[model samples]
Target: MATIQFRLRSKANKNVSIKVRLSIDRNNVFELNTGFSINPKDWSETNNLPKQTTPENKLLSSDLKKLDSYIIENLNTDLGKSILIDSNWLESKINDCFSRVVKTDTSLLINHIQHIIDNANTRKVKNKIGLSASTIKNYTLFRNIISEYQKKIKKQIQFIEITKPFVDKFTNWLINTKNYSTNYAGKQLEILKTVCIDAEKNEIQVAPYSKIIQHFRESEKDRYIQTLSFEELELILNVDLSNIEQLNQFKKENPELTKNLSITPESLNNVRNWILLGCEIGQRGGDLLEITRENIRYNGKNYYIDLIQQKTNKSVTIGIIAPHVIDIVENNLPKKIPHQKLNEYAKVICKLAGIVEVVKGTKLNTETNRKELGNYPKYELIASHCFRRSFASNYYKKIPTPILINITGHSKESLFLTYINKREDKDANADLFMQFYEKLNKDKEPQLKIIKSGTND
Candidate 1:
């Protein structure tokens, strides 16, 4: 049997380094660095350990004992019995022992990320619903991008290696090499930070990269949130789908024009009603697409939308107060519509409604594989999310913020305010603020009093 003993190396500048010595049958000896140095006076030759019982010394003693036990445990294994008991074998065992016991090899940055992704694949959010398909897709994409980043750098990194410099280099690679937008790159970094935080909870050291993620900022141009005005909503509602059938007939007669105008009357009517419903209820596309006749509830006098939001898993009741919503609920309404198709038809509906106001927005230029900001027609910016924002923005002051937030599932007041305030029409925002300013000043005007800087004046 091999006996492990703690010993001190030669003292230099009053500091003595500790080493573990393994004696095999009291003949051959092997020394391993404990990677700890202490004051010469703190070493106790009699006890063969540190002299004091301070917290630091106690931890060091515990580590030394753990390392000693690890070696002994391995020596008793079947593989250990087959190998020759010599200094060379003991030295190799030391490396294997640290790798197994201390997790020095398996705790690489990429490995921890893969573990997080694998665990996320099986994670449930509201105890029943698993992670959304899009979420899983994004995580997989992020993992692939990280792997590519590692390949580009030609080295594997540890968790502790994630620092500001690493973030900077990775961000630049995402923007330049991968052609990701600033907002998208920031989102990827946010996901990476989230994974790093999870790794930290599992006792992984990641403090070096925690603060670096906060510095990532998406440009203001990239932060535009599209919303429809009441006029634009009315225009879409009033669009004549009767001509859509004629257009389809025309497309059949002329095949070349089919690509430009390939809409049908039924599809147009379906998306129009869906958009009207979404604008009235202010629900996300996930919940909007799931709506059915079963979701409508009547409380004797009034009707309400009673459904649990799919994204948040929170039950919300939206009163059927809007005239258009009431009409749709009382009349014929589609049981379900594809969310992607709804978004596509919504843009076409907006365009036909003459909602062509120029606005700044980001678009992925497929030719260059990069996101560039340019002036696009207002209809091009219209999406399913715009319906929710339109509801919030149009009725921000008409309804109580708390009540709206309850329906929207926004947890924070500040975030809700920010969401509603992101308007493309500057004049509309100014008008809302002006109304607030007028209301405040209407009650009482401030009486001005002037005082000279010098009392003599």
Candidate 2:
């Protein structure tokens, strides 16, 4: 059981600071500041009430009594009984009381979201590191966009006031007014939904807008899953950047391509080797570029690349079997390549290798600042992601699905297949059904019968 009573600090002037003293089991005790000061002459020590008959004193007395009763009521509730009665619990209850009594609208939509962002930025996860810097930046961007939306509408909204219509309007505003792409707009809404979920966990009021948020899912049509074929991969690998004289002669022959080929022979070779390693291992740019001598392990017969995936934080060990992969590991184990520069150099390398076959894909038109889907030369669509997709696509059927899934860190077969853009053709379809058909008829004997034709009769 707990007891609550009002007490006053020493007088500084005509008034003294007042606070509530809480005691549990007659042993544990703590004081909570009420942020109130009252004249000592007006306070009655006998009844623990203000002696003044004025409206202000009457209201103050009634508030104090109500606050005491609220604490008592809460102590009897399920949550109160489950939690240990302590200073922290008392402080939280006091805050809840103040929020309900003083600031009834503290849990407004934008206000609570801002609170969540602030909390998230300070939270520590995994090895005591704070939220990812990129994530914090995104949260700042989300807040700014929401602020703009509020200003444009000339209206402030509370959490309870949010509805499905509000979500639709905000989404439309992001797309039509802000000129954001569908996928980008959907990401913004997804961040908002995440904040709402966090807010709900903190007991902040939020409208049920998850159903509306589900409608703004990122569309698959907006994504471009491009990859390099075995031939294209070979083309990139075979590009001889080693002979500087030949490269110089080739540059002179194609003066227009000299600007892209201005990189030093050594730098070009480094980028080439990095791309080959990425293709062979199927690692993301972040994970692939960061590999070093320390990440390589040898068990006498075979070498392996062991590292934790940057995005999923799952540890994976990929076997190094390809001759080119083994060569890169033996020679350039600790190579350093910037991800952005790698992507840029990869495009140039692919172009120099004559991998200019036109293909249907998405390319960003810098002049128009929008992604346009059309037929583009294969080199134009080359990026670090292509290496991962290429690795997945090239060896998908050759390797066992479970083992491949382990190497790729993919949890689902459908997602893995989609990542590689695999499809069922006539041969593959027939092969799949044939296995089941053969098994079903394995125990049954052949049942062929001869039929006489009408002409023969």
Query: Could you tell me the TM-score of candidate 1?
Result: 0.67
> Which model scores highest in TM-score?
1
lDDT of 2 by residue, 1-457 (tens): 6778897766555887778888766677888876566887778788877776789898888878877887778877835468777776676777777674323456666776667567764665655555655577788888888788889999776665567888888878888877777767888988878777766777777778742465364345545677878888788889877787877776677564345545667877888888888888888888898898889999999999999886656689999998878988998653686677788778778887889889888777777687677998888788898988888888876665667778888877777876776643557646756776897989998899988786855
Cα lDDT tens digits for candidate 1, 1-457: 6678888876556877788788766566778776567776777788778876688888777777777887788777734568766655666676675553333654576787677667765765657546666677778888888888889999876777778888888888888888887767888888888777777778887756563575364544447767888888899889787785665664576453234443777767888888888898999987888888898988898989988876556789999887887889989575576676677678777876788899987655768977677888887778888999999988886776678899898877777877765424457556877887898899796799997788774
Backbone clash count, each prediction separately:
0, 0
Alpha-carbon TM-score of each model against the true structure: 0.67, 0.64
Task: Name the lDDT of candidate 1.
Answer: 0.76
Q: Weakest 10 consecutive residues, lDDT, candidate 2?
A: 210-219
- Model 2: how far residue 389 lies from native, Å: 1.4
